[model samples]
Target: MGVGDVSKRILLGRKLRSSQLGETLLPKRIALPVFASDALSSVAYAPDEVFIMLGLAGASTYIWSWKIGLAVAVVMLTVVASYRQNVHAYPSGGGDYEVATVNLGQTAGVTVASALLVDYVLTVAVSVSSGVQNAAAAVPWISHHEVVVAVVLVLALAATNLRGVRESGAFFAVPTYCFMAGVLGMALVGALRASDGHLPDVESANFQIIPAPGYDGGNLTGLALIFLLARAFSSGCAALTGVEAISNGVPAFRKPKSRNAATTLLLLGTIAVTMLMSIIVLAHHMQIKYVDDVSRLRDEQGNPMPSGYDQPTVMAQISKAVFDNFTPGFYFVLAATGIILILAANTAFNGFPVLGSILARDGFMPRALGSRGDRLAYSNGILVLAFFACILIVAFDAQTTRLIQLYIVGVFVSFNLSQLGMIRHWTRHLKAETDPAARRRMHRSRMINTFGLGMTLTVFIIILLTKFLAGAWISILAMCAFYALMRGIRRHYDKVNLELAADEEDRFMPTKVHAVVLVSKLHKPTLRALAYAKATRPNVLEAVYVSADDATTKALVQEWDDRNLGVPLKVLYSPYREIVRPIVEYAIQIRKASPRGVVAVYIPEYVVGRWWEQLLHNQTALRLKGKLLFTPGVMVTSVPYQLESSQIARDRARRDSERVKAGDLRRGTVRSGGRVPPGKQVHR
Candidate 1:
């Protein structure tokens, strides 16, 4: 046990039994929030974006919000149906990357991976930032500290996710459900109130929005209006950011993974569309006009009242009007909106890791990412997602509006690549199918993919054209950077594989083994090393020391003679008090003298527990081993002697592992190297 071991245990958490892996699987009730929150929570801000983009032309264009919402809903439904085919066809959890690489080509798969990675990062920044803004609406103290608040929330989410997916999923279920119920309930109540002539008007209804520099006072015709509308549609498509997570996480579901994932996707689309439409309708009835300026929203008069006014979110404004007389309803809507914003990023957390694991398995990422943790989950992938998401949060100061500019590009890239891949998959499969039924099934899949491809490609072009200068270029640059990075990693791995490959030229046998023991003074560690080297029965064995002082060197030589040591001691004189360099030079001299022989250097090392103890020892041995490694005929071996402090570290690790815990969900009754009992394979 040592400081390194302690740090590793702290980072990775205590090991869990293989049998307890089932405890990490999610039931649909919890999985919905875990995987669908990003899409479902878009209702809070999707309408805001729509209004914001339209506000560029003034509020007169707000009449078209429903049309845009409907278009987005149709695209979402098409994409979901298209992905149902994806999950069912390729349920190994590679998702878009797998679909593209297998069906399209390597280049397309890389394109999809880069897009998904960028999108996942934006998801965290946007969702957490939106959550912070919602919180600011309630607690003004948070307004000035939005970035700090978002960063803190990101860290908390990372810690929760590090506990395992099932745990975090269950924890987020309440907020997600509450958000759905609150929004749906408010919509219903507002509808009834409107029918009874008791509906309340939103605060924004009193204010006016000035059109942008070039517009027809928010009433326009021709290409200019169409372009503005397209930009709004692209922005509204932010609702689709997390839709692909279901396909990416198919393997995480229980039995019938593809079917479950497809069902979940349908549920996500229905809920998101319903919530989005309800909020838009309610906002229209409430006359909510969102403004980019918090101070400019006034009640027609020139007075800047209500402490300069902090404009609530689109959902907040709708909630304020719909629940004008019901304080609890307002609070419920506000609270749920805030909670869902935070949990929305959880979908990215779940998706990014799974996609990273797939990439790693495909040799595009570090192999450790493909390996499972104690929970049988891809923990490294989760950690990588947390790290990148935190970087984005800090970079953008957690402002959702600014972050939103970088959102849809990635999802669309993935969408277009995946759809194109699906089309290819059907074409390839249809070539082999002779039966009419099989051919018909493939044809149907192809048609679904063809429709999806057309829609996604159109949106992709819209996103690039409209958002290129409005910060979308940043995402494209990021995707390219990731693509180049992944390509470089693959190239490095290929080079290493070539270098390490075994061949006839490298199979030559060594003539003899010559063992050298590094000695400072005759101590227990040195004695142990000498004994161990002797047991190897090399062709020659000797003890070597470098002498910087004559008195100590003579005493050591006399002591060696007095003890009648079995091995001979060779001493070298050094003007400077250098130890590692002289030993390394001497080892090279021995190896150069006998080119065909192998020189084995046994260095005695002390194993200590405390971090500070490491600095006090092994300075020379470490340098010596590093230098000796380059010599062609030399091998370095460490002989470890554990000190008392090591026992404390070992005990600490054992306690942290919690081996005695009996009833924990992540604990199990299995012994070492044993299989789990029958009927205990799956966890709820």
Candidate 2:
């Protein structure tokens, strides 16, 4: 075993056959953690955001924290219901992108994709950073090292996900479920205590929230209150960030993929809504005062908190209050909160790569992204997502509030467009069907989609109005970037496809086939090239060599005659010690003489296995081929003679390919001349 082979085996584990891919299909239990962790984890901090937003209008505004939570829950459930329809209608895992493309056209589709792409990247950044922030509450060291810790967590999460979905799910499922139980358990305990009038005060209960400018005291009513509610509702909508992931990852489910995914989505929505509402209610009951700016929170008589005061998150405060009698309960909730925040980002890991594969397969992204690695994971997409997420974490210093501002913009963009597309989807299907039952179902689905569109559109506008200036524009800019990039890639692929498309004129042949073999020595590689050229039986065959040294040229001419070679040998002299330019000029001259003729420049090349050996040969021939490839009436063929080392490389490739046996990987099974070959080839 080679060192590289050993390392790869250690990194990816022993390879599984393609047929075992079914083992990777997620069961409902596993799929929940894999896809819904993000939405569910919102319980940890979403309530804090609600209170913080309302804090801008003083503690009096805290009266409506539960109301904002309800509104956010409504939007979230509506989105989940709409996506359930999407999963059933299009279970191929293209999700919103596919629906938008098929119904609203490609431009709209790419726009959604771009938004989702940016959103997924932010999902990782925000989730990991938030998780670290939660941890910082329990461990003071983490607060000072937030960005570094978050970046490290992102990398570790990415590595875990690279092990394929099922494995990562099994690994993450425990923490995710524990988090759900801990938060829900805390909420239950708090409710019981509140009913008995025994609920304890939170850490921030004594602090009075001072309203920001223009919203002090009774300044929040009418238009001001309406707008404040909208802003708070928008902030609370962060709970909806990962709702669409289930729709995007429907294919990851076990048998009856759509049904299983929909069930998981429902559970996710219910748990998330219950948790968000419960947390908000608990915070209000405990009188937890949370604020965007810690300094905005003061003590009795409007006095500022002493320099040493601390303000924990709303969830943190509620955890302390509800679990005050039992220290372990508080620690358990905090630990789970931190864990779920980190794992919530796994939803993106499961989603973005699959969506990226679909886009790549459709020619919007580099085809390399469409490939699966040894573990059957979209490794390229995973890595790309992690890299960008790390960049954002570093840029924002892993501050959740800052990253949160940029968080839901993309999700809402996708949400609005996706719902609009679903409505169109149902309308188009209704046109093709006539059964009373089916028509009724279609109309019902369309109604759901329409409601979803209206709700999402309203929230989308609110998000823009509320958070546009507060880091949301950064996400919008990112979406624009991805849109332009994908469009450009698609345009390139379309142009190439059109240019290479075969027409009847493609069958037209040149007046004659001219073959020129460029040789540097009387070696086996040269002889093999000569044989391959002769086998083709061109109308004209000749050998050409660019000679910079007169002595070597004389020796080669003498050797050619001694060998009695039938083909003509032409030696072009290069006074400047250049080889490629002279041969390119010769091929061009040949083409001009017989514009109707085709020139096949057969370059005798050496194929070496080791990287360094490749550098030792083919420098001149590579440059010559590059130049002649653009010449009219030319076909540059690399007639390669494989060296012994190539056997090792070929065997390595064969073993690597054995791990994947279906889809595009199976293309290797196609015999030569049947499928288009690799590398550049030009013909008139």
Candidate 3:
């Protein structure tokens, strides 16, 4: 194997055959972390957002933190329930896009796809950015380099995911579970301490929140108060961002895919809601003062917080307060939280690629995205997601607050539409069903989806009203751009399909084949091309050479005539010393002369084994082939003259093919005889 191949093998592991795709399927245990990490990790920042938004009206308004958390929880659970119907109905992993397309037509489906696509990109950005921001709490140095760290984390996640789903899942499972355990354990300890009247105050508890300009004194009652609450709720609703990923990834689950997926979704929603509320209640009880602006926090003496005072995340504060006696527990919680937040991007890494594959399969995306890489993963899709995510992280400076504003807009757009699609789905099914038992179940699902639609629609409107000017417009514009792009791709694919459709004219043979051999020297390759062109037995045969120098051209003609090659040679003299343009012009002239006939151009090309050797040969032939390919009725063929170096490439390919891969022995793909695979042969 070559260096590149060895490096790829080391990075991605051994390539698996198509049949081993089943081995990548996840059971419920693994699927939970793979698909639910985004939702579960949201607890780390969701409460902070709630507190930040409420802090706009000062600490007194912090009393509404748990209320906002409860509201988000209700919406989250409703979304989870609604999606249970989705997985059961559409287990093909299309998720919202599939539901919207099948029920609401192509436009709605494409819109949902666009929204989900943008949202998935934002998921990676916001999740990784938030993780880095939280990590900055413990490692103050990370704060100055957040953008660089976040970009690197995004790339690392992409590389891990490129290793295939099962392997990536197994790698991420530990951190995800540890995060859950750490947060829940911290919450449990906090609750116990509170019951025993021994809970300590968080670091920010003594700081007073200075309300924003408009909400001074926290006594505003009217549209201003309503708007403030709405903005806070919208920010809090960021928790619902990744709920649809599970439905989109149902196919990744093992047998009884839908059931296992539904169970996972339920668990995700329950755990996420519990953790979110726990954090909010604990922060409120401990009087944790989280804010977007550090200046908004004042000390007990009513002085602004000192400069360079690094504020810890709400989770970090809670962990410190809850585990104040056990220093390792505090660090463990912070470490787990930070790691899980980063791993949360894994959910998008899995969902986006699968969705991209589906979109590609449906012709809305480039076909390359539909293809599996050596590891059987959608490598193209993963790379694309990572790339766009890095751009966002850099553009926004990896500020979670800034990215979070643009985050949930796309998700809510998808959520509302997906829920609407599910409602229509159940309605459509009910029309064709006569069995009372099944009808009852359909009615129940429809009602659940109807409620879901109402809830999501309300949240969607709230998000638009509250966040449009706060960078949400950018996400909306992104979704619109994606929608138009996908539609344009579909139209292009359709136009190409229509144009390429075989017709009666396609059945007719060309009137005659005029064969022309391209030559630059009187050599064996030129003679071989002449022979191959003659073997075709065309109606007209000639050897054409572009003469950039008269002396060399005269010598070549003299040699050709001396050899009596049995074919006339036509020399086109170029004043500009251009070889490809003159040959292209000649081929086009021949094609124009006989529109109903075919012009066959045979060019001798050198096939070299070494990469550097390739640049040394085939330059003229490659350029000529490229130009002639666009000429109507012209056929370009490469007559390869293999050099001695090509033997090296052949040997390398043989060694690579004979090399044994993982699982080859167990799969019986390798020879069962005593003969070992090439690399495994023992030498005494």
Candidate 4:
């Protein structure tokens, strides 16, 4: 194989046949990390956002941290329950898009798709950025270079995911589980210490929070206090961002896909809620002070924190205080938290491509996205998600706080729509059901959906009211743009489908075929083209040459006449030294003369296997074919004469194919006796 092929094989591993797709299906153990990492990892940063928002009203307002966490937990559980119905009903893996499309209309479906697509991109950005930010707490050097690190992390995650679902899931499952263990272990230790009255204070516990300009003295009441609490709740609701991915990825689960997926969702909700609340309660009990602005922190003497003071993240502070006696436990928690946050982007990497494939299959996206790559993954969609995510990371300089504002708007938009769609789905099903048992089940499902809709709708409105000016508008605009672009793509596909529909006119045969073979001189390639054209037995045949030099043209004509080649030689002089234009003009003339007939042009090309040799030959023929393809009633054919170098390439390919891969013999794809099986031969 060539260098490029070798490199690709090393990077993506051996290609699997289409039948091996079933082998790639994820079991519940692997599926949990693959689909739930985003929600689970949110505990690493979601509490920090809550504390940051509440710090606007000073440390006294921090008392509301656990309350906000509870509110977010309720929304998350409701969303999880609602999507359980979704996975059972729409197991084709369309998720919210399918639900909205089937129950509502096409517009609603497209809107949900646009929102989900935007949110997936944000998931990667926010997750990676937050990871980098948390890492900065332990490694101060990373703070200055957050953008580069975050971008590299995004690319690394994309490459890992390109190796297919099962492989990537196996790779990420350990770290995800480790993160869960570390955080929960730390929380457990902190609880034990607190019960014994031996828990140490966090580093920031001694610093006083300076309230913002409007909320001075932490004595707010009325609309101002309500708005402050609303803002804090909205920020905490980011925990609900990735709950829909499981519903979207139900097909990736093994046997009883919907049941496994529902179980995974329940586990995701329970674990995520537990971790989130644990972190918030610990931070509050330990008086962990996290703020957006460092100047807001005051020392015991009421002096502002030093300019260069680097405050650790909420997780970092809590871990340090909880594991103060054991240094290794603290670093382990931080390391696990950072790694899990980075791996959280894996959830989006999996969900985005599957959803993109579905969208492409439905004609709302480019067809190329629907195709599987050599590894049987949606490589195009993965690359697209990574690219946009890198752009966002760079554009915002990888600041989690800045990107967080643009994060949950799209998810909430999808959540509200998805919940509404489920309500309609159950209602429509109930209308058609006659059995009392099934009817009662449908009623219960509808009620759950109705409650879900109300919860999500309230959260959506709160997000809009609290975050619109805080960069949420940008995400809304992005969703609108995606919606319009998909609609336009569907329109173009439909128009092309109509234009290409076969009709009686397509059945009509051309009256005659006027054949013209392109020639520069008398040679084996030119003669081969002449013989091939004559073999077609067209109504008329001629050899056409573009002449830029008179003497060369005369010699060629003299040689042609001396040989008495049966076909007439036609020479077209080009004063501008343009070969393609003359041939295009001549073909157009022939086409215009007999509009109902076809003009066939034959060009001889030298096929060279060496990459550099290819550039040295076929320049003129390549340009000529490109021009002729655009002309109506014109057909261009390439008669290739393989060069000697091509034989070397063929030999190399043969040797490469003969080489045994790792699992060929074990899988019975190749025989140990060195004899080929009937249908197991490699064709490429």
The C-alpha lDDT values of all candidates are 0.85, 0.88, 0.91, 0.92
**Candidate 4 per-residue C-alpha lDDT over 1-684 given as tens digits, one digit per residue, 9 for 90 to 100:** 778988999999999889989999999999999999999999888998999999999888888889999999999999899989899999989999998888889999999999999999999999999999888888989979999999999999999999999999999999999999999999899999999999888999989888878789558888988999999999999998889999999889998999999999999999999999999999999988889999888998889988888888999999999999999999999999999999999999999999999999999999999989888999999999999999999999998999999989988887888888888888888889999999999889888889999999998899999999999999999999999999999999999999999998999999989999999889999999999999999999999999999999999999999999999999999999889999999999999999999999999999787889989999989888888889999999999888889998888888877777777766666775573655765433
- Could you tell which candidate, 2 or 3, scores higher by lDDT? 3
Model 2 residue 12 distance off true place after TM-score fit, in angstroms: 1.9
Worst 10 residues of 1 by lDDT: 660-669
Q: Would you list the clashing residue pairs of candidate 1?
A: none
lDDT tens per residue, model 1, 1-684: 446755655754666677777677776777789999998988788889988887777778888888998998899999999999999999998999999899888988998999999999888889989998998898889988988888888878877777678878888999999999999999999999999999889887878766666764446888989998999999999888888988888877887777788889889888888888888887877777886655444458745547746778988888887888898999899989998998898988888878887788777888888877755667787778778887888888887888899988999999999999899889988888899999998999899999999998999899999999999999999999999988888888889989999999678888878899999998889989999999999999999989999999999999988988799999988889888778888888888888988899999999999889999999888888888898888999999988899997788776655443434444443445443454453243
The alpha-carbon deviation from the true structure for residue 356 of candidate 2, after best TM-score superposition, in angstroms, is 1.6
Superior by TM-score: candidate 2 or candidate 4 = 4
lDDT of 2 by residue, 5-61 (tens): 778777767666677788899999999999999999987777778887888888888
Top candidate on lDDT is: 4
- Which window of ten consecutive residues has the lowest lDDT sum in model 2? 675-684
Q: What's model 4's overall lDDT?
A: 0.92
